[model samples]
Target: MSTPARRFDTDVLVVGAGPAGLAAALHARARGLRVAVLDPRVAPIDKACGEGLMPGALAGLRGLGVTVTGQPIAGIRYLASGSCAEARFRAGPGAGVRRTDLAAALSTAAQDRGVQVHRATAGPVTQDADGVTVAGIRARYLIAADGLHSPVRRGLGLDAPVRGAPRWGLRRHFPVAPWTDLVEVHWSRHAEAYVTPVGPGQVGVAVLSGVRGSFDDHLAAFASLADRLAGVPGTPVRGAGPLRQRARRRVAGRVLLVGDAAGYVDALTGEGIAVALAGAAAAVDCLARDRPQEYEAAWTAATRRYRWLTAGLLAASRVTPVRRALVPAASALPAVFGGVVDALAGHSDGGRTTSARTRWHHLEGAR
Candidate 1:
């Protein structure tokens, strides 16, 4: 016979233990809400990401109770079409941390806050007006932090809405020293390769492209970094599947979406973490008042802002016919190039005059 359903009560139930879920749980617990998080993966959720922490994202992390270490890259370097320029980090601070390190840190922070965490391989999420039940436990609130393909979102019938272009991610660690502190983005006609120096001894590279093929094949495009990749003694190369660039809605009923679950953009902007943390913080406020309107407003503001920025970045990536042409142009124009880098590194607001309205406009220019 099947076991009877298990029952319990909590203020909020979070699905997926990635950055978004962890941030949501931590925020909820801080606000005196009893919270629990469930994810199939145990800890250190990994994905093929650029792994550079932009300035805006850094500020968001501090607010979420996570500490980022290391010196900031002076600015971003462009290697498309053989151009090169070093722009300074526009945001107050920036860092390069592996995706695994970030996820592990967030998980520890969530546990410290007294939120219950469950690692489930797979299960069904059923909800009604009173609460939501996952696997079996009941909760007064539910959140979908389950990455790009969210089962919670599907169950809630919130699927079918997406935005922007489509791309795939492939990642790997080179067993060599990082070529430079600055993030080196090598743009090609077919694919764009991002090189981030995680530290003195290692570098992580992510190739975002429109093509569908093997990870090893994509790495060939960055043959320029071959020497650097050769020096890292223990770096391992890995890859991530296709990522949807946008999502239609971020919040529905007791169910709210955060991180890649809510929406995602090409890693070119390096704004994913910042956006998720900001959204999670907003989610806490929305949940506190139990206001659907407030949650909608918050989600719209956060994702919409990032989407606008990514569109511009993608458009600029197509300035030249040959991939080689883009790099040289980037190297030649430091100010214009740095401005884009500053925007990615979170310096778009330019401090004194930077406001949400202004930031949105700057992001639009990138498109």
Candidate 2:
């Protein structure tokens, strides 16, 4: 009897069905690749996030055919003490949506695209010159979009230790009408609180800090924000931790890392979703060309500015005096502040054209 030929269950095995994973699968399918997505959890997954989508991010989702409802965000607002700087978006409008709502949209898109999504846990990823295997299924390629702590990256020895001061994110929802159309970042001594309206009658607040406490405790740092929520009940708090994470390399043989699994810094600017969607496009293109190794360079260019800008901003916030003056200084220079906010919102034409050193004083101290 002749030996049987080996076969892969799908052309690509996607481990993780989060936004990145789902985006990768959908994009791959659009290119006529057979894709299989697996996530241990069921649909409509929820994670702690700012849940504010920049205009580019919203455009990316619609381009992928994922339609999710959200409240329009006109701009960004930085508040501290009694001073605040406001920047109206010049490119387009971003939106604030609940994580569960975004998850549902992604899941529906993947299913509608005829992509195979499995609700099974992936264990022991193995890859070779021919194909990659997870559990018993095999495919020509694998995308490890398993988030901050990616198990597939660990399995392939690509996990890198994150080096930075520890920071975490905690978020809760209040059933109140939105006070503003812009996403608000209220800076305090040791924390940054983000308030975004997810619906006409619902607002989400996420706190990024190194402090440990209840949601109310974190809110105490911002008296004005706390006063707004006085006597108002909130949903259960959701949390994500040690915000910084890293991976050794984006590629390991036939496997490619996408999304947070690839690497991440603190969520200071609320650009995670936009960057991840862009990475998915690059990743799927690389896979199509049978050039997995080239993905490392692609990944770098896709995220170079984000990593640089976020790191620089986070570093500045760590200094006590600098944190105190950030909002006030930005308030004085509305044009300069608007440029930075526009850059973060994914609008190229609205960002700074000068070097970081040139604007250091503008962002360093208002006192």
Cα lDDT listed for each candidate: 0.69, 0.85
Give the Å shift of residue 188 in candidate 1.
1.5
Model 2 lDDT tens row, 14-89? 9999999998887787665779998889889999999999987887776676778999999999999999899988
- Evaluate model 1: give its lDDT: 0.69
What CA RMSD would you report for each candidate?
8.0, 9.5
For every model shown, what is its TM-score relative to the native structure?
A: 0.85, 0.92
| Candidate 1 runs further than 4 Å off | 1-8, 70-72, 161-165, 230-236, 316-329, 347-367
Best-performing candidate as measured by lDDT: 2
Which residue pairs clash in candidate 2? none
lDDT (10s digit) by residue, model 1, range 1-367: 0112234477788888888788788777665577888877858888768888887776666655577665355557766434566777755557888888888888887777677888774377667766677767687778888887777667666776545456788787764566577877776667877778786766777888878866667766666765445444434556664576345566665677777777665666777777777777777767766674577677776566567777666766655554445566666766777676766666222221122224334444655
